[model samples]
Target: MRKARWLIAVLILCAGVALSQKASGDDAADRAAFEAVCGSCHPVSMASDLRSESEWKETIEVMVKAGAKGTDEQFEAVRRYLRQNLTNVNVNTATAAEIAPVLAVSEATARDIVKRRTEKGNFRTIDELKQIPGVDAVKLEARKDRIVF
Candidate 1:
């Protein structure tokens, strides 16, 4: 009975790990498509610019017209990723995933933002956010309109 219980516990742990990996894997695939399609013409770094879903859709259409190569599914993936990530983020509540693309920062920087928010409380301004190590002041300034406390 003890062995059976231990085996069940291990299996549950493994299943939980697998589920989390699958979620990250889907995001990874979306990110890959975004990079490949956008990076083909210019730096994928451009994706960091905060935009509404409509604006991103327009930009993607223009890129496609300019011969950005991607299948419909790939383009859709890019659109979905941008629409989801490159939007207004509440510093008090956003996850690293949401903050990273909107601020044009790395995942590490975004995680730092989250850590700071947890430790120091909700950020009230761009200056407060900039105090976090790894966050770029310039990028935060540029995307200030997309940030909320």
Candidate 2:
């Protein structure tokens, strides 16, 4: 059944292409969702790719409950989009530029954050950002990803 084998191969090839397209479609959807909503409050490049599905879900919930006005469906979309796009591994030190965009803080403030962190030496954990005058626990959590050592 040479004809049957050929048909099966063609179908398999088509299926593979469809699967790739579906993955890319999901990425496009996530990017669109993030751009439409999160773009207002957060700098597009400020936040990290993502940590995990659950992390994104919880973070979105926190933002919405705090003041963000996106619909539940929209929020979910944002969460999914962020989760897919923003998951990073390096977490020890941070740059002022990286910290500034996410916190709505000034470059001066970001420099201060660096200064304080430098003075204190390496941070043993994320909570140490609180030692910086203008930084607080919530703010630290927000920028923890960009920080290391």
Candidate 3:
């Protein structure tokens, strides 16, 4: 009986470990994507702020059009991670992901553009952002006037 109980406990412990490990793997995958794709423009100094889930979805849309170059699934994953990390309770110090939603572009697009802008300082006008990575004068011509604070 003693041996059987010990075995049962061991099994439970192993299962718990496995579950945590799986969760950790998912987190790492999100981090990896951000670093690999989002790192080109933004510095990976430390974890950035994250915001709302709904906003994240929108941000993803913007990122896609702006040249994020991710599959729909991957984009969604990034969005989920951002939402998970940056809930509404913490918007003020929200990381880039959180702010992504509030941006004019979708979360993902906002992620790309903002990170680039963060590294580059600030964008005061559309004319200045025209030179931004995915932004061009032609593209700017149509939306330049539309861009606002």
Candidate 4:
């Protein structure tokens, strides 16, 4: 009985280790997909800042239109990886580079945002984003959850 119990305990421990490793391996695959697909155009850091899942989807769509290539599975993996790693960023204090990717806006728009913030102080609410020229209020409203003041 003692020997049987010891064997059972060892088997359980081994199974746990195996399961943990499999989870890590899945994460590694997602990271690989992210690097292979998105890193082709820009550094992985470009997508490291947080955005809502919807925002990520929109960004991915734009990238596809812009000639970024990847399988649907790979794109899904990259999106999942981005969603898991990136979270909400404070737009009020974020740089143009940081805001561009996270907000899924043009670099010019990001520069405008930074410039506006510099001139007018921090944004008090998402509604104020409309004050910036070329910012679509409807789109900004859709992504409000990812934008923080």
Candidate 5:
């Protein structure tokens, strides 16, 4: 009985350590990507402020337009890092302006989202976002976890 209990505790401890290490690895990768791409042009501090995912996307777009050289994967990594760290908008309750920056959609699309919500009701599922005109299904899928009911 004593040996069995000890073994169980050891397994639990190992599992916890593995999970912790995985989380740290993810953070490290995001940090590395952020530094390598975004940090190359300006202080990483420039991105420290919390912004909506849409806002981060816009920032990345502007940087690309201004000739910030990076592959699509690198730009995507930076965008994901920013979105995970910064986005806090609630799609169910936010105004068009608030939704625009968080979802990386144009103001017109944001307005359409709001209009649909108003005409129908509170969205019960992320999939319901498809009802909005001009919403990209792939983009919405990528943001599913971050979105609030």
Candidate 6:
């Protein structure tokens, strides 16, 4: 019975790892598609300026109208990637999970941001956010445009 239980646990662990890997692979492909489609006309660096979902959708529409070329699958992948990884967040109102991906911060640091906000109230400025311990000031500065308070 113990051996059977151990085998079951190992199978579950393997399945979890496999799923995670597949998700990561999908993300990588999506990112590549975004770069290929967007890079055709403008530098991919320009995309680092985070936008809202509607804004990204509109931008993609404009680009397509203006002659950006990609398959429907590629365009969809690009859209999904942008929405998942590049969209902005309202830090004052956003959950830790939302903040973590947008700001490229760890979950622990994101939780700390929530804790600080809970204790002291909403953040009004970059300087205020920079004051949070364990939060990277430079990274915050780099993504300042993506942050809304």
Best by lDDT: 6
* Better structure of 1 and 2 per TM-score: 1
lDDT digits (tens) for residues 17-42 of candidate 1: 99999988988999999999999878
Per-residue C-alpha lDDT of model 5 across residues 1-149, encoded as one tens digit per residue: 99999999999999999999998897778778888887777898877766665667788889778877767777777776776566766777888877775676889998998888888888888778876778888887876666777
For 1-149, candidate 2 gives per-residue lDDT tens digits of 99999999999999999999998997787787777777777786665554544456677677667677766677667766653346332223556755554444577877887777677666576666565667667855765674445
lDDT of 2 at 144: 62
When sorted by lDDT, best at the front, the candidate numbers are: 6, 1, 4, 5, 2, 3
| Per-model CA lDDT versus the true structure | 0.83, 0.64, 0.57, 0.80, 0.78, 0.87
Which regions of candidate 4 fall more than 4 Å away from where they truly are? Answer: 89-149
Off by over 4 Å in 2: 49-67, 88-149
Error of 3 at 71 (Å): 2.3
Clashing pairs in 6: none
Itemize residue pairs with steric clashes in candidate 1.
Answer: none
State, as a TM-score between 0 and 1, how close model 4 is to the true structure.
0.58
- TM-scores, each model vs. reference: 0.59, 0.46, 0.49, 0.58, 0.57, 0.59
Error (Å) of candidate 5 at residue 145 is: 19
Q: Please, what are the lDDT tens digits per residue for candidate 4 over residues 23-68?
A: 8999899999999999998897887666755677788889899999
Residue-pair clashes, model 2: 9
Q: Model 6, poorest ten-residue lDDT window?
A: 46-55
lDDT assessment of candidate 2: 0.64
Clashing residue pairs in candidate 4 (N, C-alpha, C atoms within 3 angstroms): none
> RMSD of model 2, in Å?
14.1
- Point out the worst 10-residue segment of candidate 5 by lDDT: 47-56
